[model samples]
Target: MAARIILNPTAGNGKAQKLFELIQAHLPNDVEVVRTTGPGHATELARQVADQEDLTVVSLGGDGTHHEVINGLMPEGKTIFAVLPAGTGNDFVRTLGYPKSPRAMLDVALYGAERRIDVGRVNDEYFLTVSGVGFDAEVAGWVNQHEKKGNGTWIFLRGILRHLVHFQAEQMTIHVDGAFRSEPTFLLAAGNSPYYAGGMKICPEADPGDGLFHVVWVKDLSRLGVLPLLTRVFRGTHVQHPQVKTFQTEQLTVEGPPNMLVHADGEIVGHLPVTMTVIPAAIRVRTGRS
Candidate 1:
């Protein structure tokens, strides 16, 4: 079979072109490279290829690029998904144990196994990672509104501090797996993958293909109490903290302030009072983790 590499040239500070060069050096002759110009272009390209070409589709940027390519390929079962990790905050690729180094990630794609994975949906949007409404989603809106430069955990750290100072908790009513919670919460995250925001393990127990989503909601924590828990999210021990509540469900409906921000996989997707549902094992993806 052939391979098609769909790249977003603007992803990861324009490092995708360099990654394409490296992949060209290491890839087989049958693989072809295609670059996307803007939002939704990758999905359209992948869909056209899926309709006409017999090829494996590889996502060659960050999670946003992967999400777009998946949107392209989701309607048909014609392609397998692979990751090249060339974008900022490659949380999904890391979840699959692929190294961010171009050569190593390429080797994993060329040699690793594939598995059926789950994808969640919020209204009409698709999310391969976590979806949220509340404090974190508000922060996502800020992240999209401003320009972020440089890398490392500090970028998200700065955003967190900025939001924490000015952000207020919302009163939400959540129905999950036949249980109900109505409270004032600072954050509510429903996770498919274990990681978010570069590498915060918000739901360490979450299994992407297990047919259920993990939800973690923090209710009424003081800023002082919130800081250390947020810090511990990287290690995934925040779930064990006193102020956090962890639950699992197949379908969840969250209603609150109609104007609260909503995010799926780190992008500001919609406003709150949204519904989320898990499509279990709905997509086939290339992975070595499972």
Candidate 2:
């Protein structure tokens, strides 16, 4: 079978392009490499390649690149999806137990087994990692707009601090599975996998193959109250905090401030009044041995 590599040249502050060169050398000579020029370009490339039966369409960038390719391929047909972690967060790959080296990722692309995984949908878009609203989504919007110099974790932390001073909690009415609640919330995340914001395990119990979402909601907290919990998230222990709540559901809906934005896999998608549903085993992906 052949491989179609869809690459986002600008991911990880142009580091993706450099890694692409190294990965290309390991790929077969006939493999097709398509470089994306702007937003939505990867989706188009993925759709074009997915039409070919028995081909593997590999995403060679960060989570946003993976997000677009998934949208383009679902409801999927014959193509198999694979990821090479050359993006800033690479959180989705982290959940799959892949190492963060280009050579290692490329080896998986070339030889890993195909496995089915769940996909999360918000409105009409499909996300492979996590989708949410509130403080984290707002921070994602800010980070996407402003260019930052340095590592991904430092840039996100800096953005969080900068936005925290002005970020406002929203009055939200949430419906999960069939249970409902109304509260003023600082953040709400529905995760298909456990990691986001570089390495933060926002929903530590999330599993993509289990046909459910691990949803986490943080009650309204003052800036200082939110600070200490930030470190705990990396260790997957933030759920123990009284201000945080976690549950599993096959579906969820949220009604919040109209101006509040929603983010899927770190790309700002739309505003709230959003619904997320779990599509069980919706796509096949190349993963390391379990």
Candidate 3:
């Protein structure tokens, strides 16, 4: 078997390209490296290679790249997937217990345990980490428009602070499994992994292989009240707060303000009125610990 590496040169502010060049000599000779040109290009490249039975398709970028690759390989689950973190906010790799060193990550990609993990689908899009609507989605929109400088955490913090000042909690109707709740929601996160928004631990108990999603919703909090909850998110203690609610389910639907944005794995997908479902053991991935 051989490896097909789909690299996004623009990810991590061009750091991905540099890392690949630095480690090119160390990679296996049978590997084929391909660089992505623009947004959604990784998906196209992945789709082109998904039918190969004796090949492993690896993504050498961040969460967005992984999300794209997963979407492209979906509905056809024959291709094996692997990831080497080379982008800012590599949240999906974090959930998989990936090492920080590029060499170690690459080693795992070449020889690691294969595990089947669940995938979350929002409308028709697939996400390996987390997806949400409202406040965090607004922050994602802000981060998308602004030029990022320095660390990803700092950039996201700046975006959150800037948007919080003018952000309004949207009225949303949420249905989980069969239960229903209609309220003013600040943020609704359905997570298949434990981390998002640069290691925030928004859904600390999420397990990608569990075949269920950890759903969290924040409601009835004033703007100032949200600050303390945001702090708890870093420690993953926000779920204990009174205004926050957490549950697990296989599916859910969210209806909110028409203009409210929705984000999947940190990339803005579309507006609200979205339905998310879980596909058990949807994709096979090479991980640090099978």
Candidate 4:
């Protein structure tokens, strides 16, 4: 019946640690808080408690931290999960309707309704939001390597612009639920829930509880077409573009051009030849939505 919070202290430039300290005064004594020492620590913490029935495991960082936590608790687990958005881009929480205030979010994390949601598995890791390869994956690498500050969307936009100027599209073959298409590729995002790289609705129609992935595929784009097309991603209107393709599938694979970087939930995990699979109602999470 107790709750354990696995928090990434360095997330948002020490913002998560500060928020955790402040919220301690308001949390019930049964709630235990554990600060992550480094990368992958949250996953280890989460795994230790994943099998504890009736327990709530709360993720108190951004998408990266949430990614680690969910990977630890999934495949099989009984612990209910919750999130307290504290990183530069809390993209996954956007789909959950979590409150913005730390105190209010704490309330929902501890006392909200529990709902089952789909999880996207890319290779071995699990992503709660969007996962992709090609140009966007390169953008994610650029954003992660440099210093991150302020609103994450602006930072990502800057990365996108910087990479777009010199980036070359790769040849890729994407297979969605058995159908295949091969061509010069811009980027393909497989989304379990909408909202990635802060607030860009890369796959606008994604629904976490629907047991499917809304995949968005962008065809090769000329340098001139990049600006106009990318600007609409925030509004998710880019899908209407003639070169863009969107579909729903339970599984898919991307092959071609080895060493092509792949990212899941904004973290660069591995290279190409990746398979994305959706696990229906894979994890239980606390949500504020009625």
Candidate 5:
């Protein structure tokens, strides 16, 4: 059994490096380890072993690292994936139900049950958590460019507050399954598993095994209404608001102003005019749950 740990030492503003110390003593004797040098390096590392059927590739950083790993493994990977949450937004690990403790997470990574989950594709990029556009995408781009001083949700909240006051909602055309409509949109998040921006359940009903995306769309909102609705998103109750709508689909499309930013798993992938589709049971993974 070959296993490799792809560690992103700079993730979580050095938090991953600190967490590595605790797990260092617990890794298997046979496990090989490698550290990522920069952005997209994790993907390059993971791709090196994606074709090994008997191998397990563990990601030991934040969601961004895991996002890179997933992109590397997708479409043809036979290796089992594992994650240890060591970053600001451990959203993917949250959805995986991994333990919060270092030793426990390591245990799950090394010996947990193997299962399969869905993968999401927006244009040519793949995502394991949520892919979003409009307001949230703009916020993601902003957060990526500045200093990351706080925890995941707090950081995202700060970015949201920075833009929410003056952010403008743009008109967008949406297509789900076979139906189509156009509306003023504040944001739209396509979720494979229900969580993003650390803990916000943007698409609360998304199920990775169900072969469908739980798409959440927030229609145009006034500044006052947007903030209140966003507050409820942490609890996933925002879906109940009149401005929000949820849909389940295997495929969808979003067409809007070309400048509208699009993000996959919190990392800005590109702009809008994207087609997102669910790839069912696309990758194998280790999880604490059966």
Candidate 6:
């Protein structure tokens, strides 16, 4: 089968270009390489290639680019997506146990086994990893708007601190599997994969193939309350905290104050009052041996 690689050279502080070159060096000599020129170009390229050619389509960029690529290839198509993880967070790639190095990642892309994984749906939108609303979405919005123009964990730190100072909790009513939670919350995340925000394992026990999605809700916290738990989240241990609640469901609906911020896989999608569900094994993923 033909293999097509869509490269976004601007990803990961422009290091995606170097990764693209390395991927080129290791790919089978017959594979075709296409460079994306600007935002959303990678998705367009991926969809076009998937529709017109019987080939494996690879996305070589960060989570946003990967997000776009998945949107381009959903709902029972023959095209298979493999990620090269050449972006800042590469969170979903990490979830699949792929190495960070370009050569190592390409080795899997070249030889990895194929597996079926779940993809999430909000209204009709697709999210391979997660969809978040409330406080974290505010953080994501701030990060995208004011992020330091460099590559490092500290940049995210600064962004979070900035958002924390001004972020406000919202009254939300969450309905999961017929259970209701009416509370003031800092954040609510529904995940198909286990992590978001770089590599923070927001739902540590999540399994994409389980035919269920996981949700994490952070209750209203004081600055003091949220701080100690922040480290726990990065360590994938925040679920142990009392103010944090985790649950699983096949479907959920969230209604919040009007004009609430919404994010899916780190990109702001729209305002709140959304319905989300898990579509069991809805997509075919190129994964390594289990």
How far is each candidate from the true structure, as Cα RMSD in Å? 1.9, 1.4, 1.2, 1.2, 1.0, 1.9
Higher TM-score: candidate 1 or 2? Answer: 2
Task: Write the residue-wise lDDT of candidate 3 on 1-290 in tens digits.
Answer: 49989999878888788879877888888999998988889999999978876678999887888888888888686788999887677789886767767788788887778889998999999999999998999998877666247456877898888988888887899987678889999999999998987889999999999999999999978888988889999899999999899999999999978899999998999998999999999888888985
In order, candidate lDDTs are 0.80, 0.87, 0.87, 0.89, 0.89, 0.79
Q: lDDT tens digits, residues 1-290, model 6?
A: 47888888888877678888766656787688888887778767777766643477788888888888877777544577788886666778866777657787887775677777888888767787889898778877876665437453555666778778777888999987668879999998998999887878887877888998888989999977777888887787898888889888989999998689888878787887899889887766677656
TM-score of 5: 0.98
TM for every model, in the order presented, reads 0.93, 0.96, 0.97, 0.97, 0.98, 0.93
Model 3 misses residue 173 by how many Å? 0.4
lDDT per residue (tens digit) for residues 1-290 in model 4: 49999989888777788889878889998999888998889999999888887899999888889989998898775889999888777898897787777788899999899899999999888889999999999989988876355457788888888898888988999887568889888999999998898898899999999999999989899999999998898999999999999999999999978888999999999998999999999888999997
- How displaced is residue 158 in candidate 3, in Å? 0.5
Report backbone clashes per prediction: 0, 0, 0, 0, 0, 0
Q: What would the per-residue lDDT of candidate 5 be over residues 126-160, giving only the tens digit for each residue?
A: 99999999999998988787636777788988999
Worst 10 residues of 6 by lDDT: 146-155
Worst 10 contiguous positions by lDDT, candidate 3:
143-152
lDDT of 1 by residue, 141-188 (tens): 666554247453566676788988878887999987677879998899
Residue 67 miss distance in model 3 (angstroms):
1.5
